[model samples]
Target: MQYSQKVLDHFMHPHNVGKLENPDAEATEGSPACGDQVSIFMKVDENTHKIQDVKFLSYGCASNIATASIITDMAKGKTIEEAKKITWKEAAEELDGLPPVKMHCSVLAVDTLRKAIKDYEIKHGLAEEDKFSTDKIIEELKKVIYPNVGEDIVSLKMVKYVGFKDGTAIVDVEIPKFDKYRDNVAEEIREHLEKFKEIKDIKITM
Candidate 1:
C-alpha cells in the first residue's frame, strides 16, 4: 500500500529515537505474539513536573514504530497533564494520515502513553480518583469467569480498555486476528455493565 508522504517520512526517519536514562516513568507495551511492542521511558523534572526527556524502543510495523517516535517527541518538555491530552488523533495528524487498517498504530501509541503516566502516578503515590470507571468489578468478574477462554464465553481476557464520559461508557476490545470467537466479547461486557442507569454509552471496540 502507498502510504501518505508524511507516513513515509516518519517511517524512514523517525524522530526522538532512543532510550532515556533513569526515567521517572517507563512502560513496556504491545503484543509480543503479534510482533508489535514498544517501551517508552520518560524523565520528569521534579520541581516542574514537566517531561524533560523521553525515548522509545519499538519492534513493529513502520507505522507503529513511527507513532512511538512521534509520541516521545511530543511528550518532551510538556507537563504530564499536557501530555495526557495528546490523543491518537494528534499522532495520526502528525503522520499526515495512516491507512484505515493501520490506524491502530496510533491508538497503541496513545494507550502506551496512558500506561506510562499511570506508572508514574503509581510511583509517586498520587492517588487521585480514577477519571473513568475502574471499579474492581472487572477483577471480581475475572475470578467468576474469564471473558472468552476455556472454551467458555467466560474465560477469555476479553476487555482491553474502557473509557467514560459523564455516564456514558466506552469499552475497547482486541479482535483476535485469528479467531472470530472473541468478536462479541465487548458486546457481552457492555450488556453486563449496562445494568446501571449511570452507564449511558457502552462501546465495543475490536
Candidate 2:
C-alpha cells in the first residue's frame, strides 16, 4: 500500500508521543488482541477549558502511529469542545489520506481522543455520563468501518438488525459469504459492543 509522505513522516517520528505525568484526563481504547490500541493523555487549562498539552501512545502499524501523532497535534491548544469536533475523516485528510484498510486507525485515534475529552468533562462536572441503550450500540456500530470501502457498515446499510436484552446483544449484519471482510466485521462488532458493561454476551449473525 502506498502511503502519503506526511503519513510516513509522522510514522517515522511521531510528535507528542509520550505520557503526561499529571494529566487532567486520560483514556485508552482498542484491544491489543486486534493488533491496535491507543492511550491519550491531556493537561487542560481549567479556566480556559483548553488542552494545554496532549500526548499519545500507540501500539500498532504505521497508520496507527501516524494517526495518533497527528491527532494529538490537532488536539493540543484546542478547547475541549473544539477537540471534540475532530473527525476521523479530517484526521485522515490531515495525514494526506490513508488506505481504506488502514482507515480504522484514524477512527481509533479519534475515538481515544474523544474518550479522553469526555473523561475531563465528567471529572470537572461539565457533562454527565450517558445512559447505555440500543441506540448507543447503533452509535458504536457507526464507528466500525467497512475496510473494503473505508465507510461505516451502518451507513453502508450492511447492518440489518440490532437488538439488546438482558445481558446479551444480538446483531445481524449483511455481508456476503465470500466477502473477505466478513469475519473482520463480526470481530469489529464484538469489539465495539463488548466495552459496554451492560452487555455480557454478543451474538453476531451474517
Candidate 3:
C-alpha cells in the first residue's frame, strides 16, 4: 500500500526509537496474535508528574512506526494529564491521515502512550490499586457485537481468553477461517474497550 509522504518520512526516520534504562513507567500494546506490537518507555518528573522524555519500539508495519514516532513527538515534555488526552484521531491527523484500513495502527500508538502514563501513576501510588481490572474488561468485551453474527462476540463463543495487567487488556478471539467479518469484529471490540478511561491498551486476537 502507498502511504502518504508524511507517513513515509516518519516511518523511515522514526523518532525516539530506543528504551530508557529504569524509566519511570513503561507499557506495551498490540495483537500478539497478529504479531504487531509496540513498547513505550517514558521518564516522568516525580514531583510534577510531567513527561520528561518518551520513546517507543515498533514491531509491525510502516504505519506502526510512523504512528509511534508522531506520538512521541507530540507527547514529550507534556504533563501527564495533557498526554493522556492525546487521541488516536489526533495521531492520524499528525501523520497526514493514515489509510482507512491502517487506522488501527494509530489506535495502537495512542493506547501504548496512555498505558505508559498509567503505568507510572500506578507504580507511584497516584492511582488506586483497583484502577485496572480484568473482569471489567471481559464484561466490556461481552458488549461487543460481532458484525456478521449479529450477536455479542462473548455469546458467540469467540472469546478465547482475556488477560489484563498494568491497564492493558489482552483478548484472544477465534473466528472461523476465511471469515470476512474479522476486521469488523476487531474494530467493534476496540470501540467498546475505548470507552473505559482506565483501559489504556487493548489487543484483540483472532
Candidate 4:
C-alpha cells in the first residue's frame, strides 16, 4: 500500500506521543489481540473546558501510531466539546487520507480521544454514564470497519441482525465466504462488543 507523504512523516516522527502526568482524564481503546490499541491522556482547563494538554500511547502498526499522534495534536488545545466532534473520517483526511485497510487506525485514535473526553465529563459531573442496551451494541457495531471498503459494516449493510439476551450478545453478518477480511471483521466486532460488561458471551454468525 502506498502511504501519503504526510502519513509517512507522522509515522516516522509522531507528535505528542507519551502519557501525561496527572491527567484529568484518560481512556484506552482497542485490543492488542486484534493488533491495535490506543490510550489517551488529557489535562483539561476546568473553567474553559479546554484540553490543556493531550498525549497518547499506541500499540500496533505505523498507521496506529501515526493516527494516535495526529489525534493528540488535533485535540491538544480544543475544548472537550470541540474534541468530541473529531471523527475518524476527519482524522484520516487530516493525514491526507489513509488506505482503506488502514482506516480503522484513525477510528481507534478518534475513539480513544472521545473516550478520554467522556471520562473527563463523567469525572467532573458534566455528563452521566449512558445505560447500556441492545441499541448501544448496534451503535458500537457501527465502529467496526469493513477493511475492504473502509466503511462501517452497519453503513455497508453487512450486518444482518443484532440481538442480546440474558448475558449473551448475538450478531449476524453477511460476508462472502472467500472474503479475505471476514475473520478480521468478526474479531473487530468481538473487540467492540466485549467492552460492555453486560455481555458475558458473544455469538457471531456469518
Candidate 5:
C-alpha cells in the first residue's frame, strides 16, 4: 500500500517518542495481533486540566507511527476537554489521508490519547472507579459484530478466556495468526472495551 509523504515523514522521525518519568497519567491502546499498539503519557495541570507535556511509544507500521506523532503535537497545551475532542478522522486529515484499510491506525492513536485523559480524570477524583465487572465485560463482548460474518464472537465461541489483573484486561481468542480477520477481532474487542476506564491496557492473545 502507498502511503502519503506526510505519513512517511512522521514515521521516519516520529515526534515525542519516549516515556515520561512518573507521568501524571498514562494509557496504552491497541491489539498486538493487529500489529499496531500505542502508549501515551501526559503531564496534566490539575488546577486547569491542561496538558503540560505529552509523549508516546508506538509499535506498528508507518501509519501507526505517523498518527501517534501528530496526535501528541495536537494534544500538548490543550485543555483535557479540548484534547478529548480530537478524533481519528481529524488525525487522518492532519496527515492528508490514509488508505481505507489503514484508517484504523488513527483510531488506535486517538483511543490511546483519550484513555490517558480518562486516567487523569480518575486520579483527580472526577470519575468513579469502573463499575463494570469481568462478567459485564464478557457480556459486552457478545454485542460486538464481526465485520465479515455478521455474527458476534461469543456465538461462534471464538472468545476463550477473559481475565483481569491490576486493572488490565486479558482476552484470549482462538484465531490463527495468518487469518485476515484475526486483527479485526482484536481491534473490535479493544473498541468495545474502551469505555471501561479501569482497563489500563488490553492484551488479545491468538
Candidate 6:
C-alpha cells in the first residue's frame, strides 16, 4: 500500500525513536491472534503529572508502527490528563487517514499507549477512586436498551476488563468472532472513557 506523505514521514525518520533511560512507565501489547505487537515507554514528571518523553517499539505492519510513533510525538510534553483525550480520529487525521483495513493498526497504537499509562499508574499506586470511572459508562449503556442483552453493559458483562494509567482508560471486551455487536460494544467503551479529560487512551480487546 502506498502511504501518504505524513505517514511516510513518520514511518521513515520517526521522531522519539529511542527508549528513555529511566522511564516512569513501560507497557507491551499485541494480538497473537492477529500477529501484531507494540511496546511503549514513557517518562513522566511526578510533580506536574506531565509526560517528559515517550517512545515505542512495535512489531507490526507499517501503519501500526507509524501510528505508534505518531502517538509518542503528540503525547510528549502534555500533562497525563491532556494526553488521555487525544483521539484515534485525531491520529488518523494527522496521518492523512489510513485505509479502512489499516484503521485497526491505528486503534492498536492508541490502545498500546493506554496500556502503558495503566502501567505508570500501577507503579505510582494511584488511588482506586481515581480509577474505575465506570459509573457514567454504565449509565450510558442503560439507554441502549438491548433486546436480550439487558439494560447496562456492566450487567451484560460486556466490559470484560477496566483499568487506568495516568488518566488513560484500558478496557477489554472479548466479543464472539463475527458478532454484529462488536463495533457497538467497542464504541460504547470509547465514548465512556472519553468523558475524562485525563483519559488519553482507551483499549478494547476482543
What pairs collide in candidate 1? 146-154, 146-155, 147-156, 148-156, 149-155, 149-156
On TM-score, the candidate that comes out on top is: 2
Error of 6 at 38 (Å): 0.9
Q: Against the true structure, candidate 1 has what lDDT?
A: 0.67
Instruction: State the displacement of the C-alpha of residue 140, model 3, in Å, after optimal TM-score superposition.
Output: 6.6
Instruction: State the lDDT of candidate 2 residue by residue for 1-206, as single tens digits.
Output: 89999999999999999999989999999988988999999999999999999999999999999999999999999999999999999999999999999989999999999999999999999999989999999999999999999989999999999999888999999999999999998999999998999999999999
Clashing pairs in 5: none
> At residue 202, what lDDT does model 5 achieve?
90
On residues 100-206, what C-alpha lDDT tens digit does candidate 4 reach at each position? Answer: 99998998999899999999999999999989888999989989999998999999999999999999999999999999999999999999999999999999999
Candidate 3 ranges with C-alpha deviation above 4 Å = 129-179, 183-206
TM-score of 4: 0.97
- Model 1 collision count: 6
Q: Backbone clashes per model, in order?
A: 6, 0, 0, 0, 0, 5
**Each prediction's TM-score against the native?**
0.64, 0.98, 0.69, 0.97, 0.68, 0.62
In terms of lDDT, model 5 sits at: 0.84
Model 5: CA > 4 A from native: 130-206
lDDT of candidate 1 over 1-206, digit per residue (tens): 55787777777998777788788998876656544778888888777779888888888899888888788878888988899889766887887766655665676676678778878877887645353344533532232212233222223445566566787666655567666545444434554565456677666666
Native-structure RMSD, model 5: 6.9
TM-score of 5: 0.68
Candidate 2 residue runs with Cα over 4 Å from true position: none
Question: Arrange candidates by TM-score, highest first: which order?
Answer: 2, 4, 3, 5, 1, 6
Root-mean-square deviation per candidate = 10.2, 0.7, 7.7, 0.9, 6.9, 9.8
Q: Tens digits of per-residue lDDT for model 5 on 1-206?
A: 67899999999998899999999999997667557789999999889999999999998999999999999999999999999999777998999888766776787798789889989999998886556789868976774545445456777788899998898899998877787877777878887787678888998888
In order, candidate lDDTs are: 0.67, 0.95, 0.83, 0.93, 0.84, 0.70
Clashing pairs in 3: none
Candidate 2: how large is its RMSD? Answer: 0.7
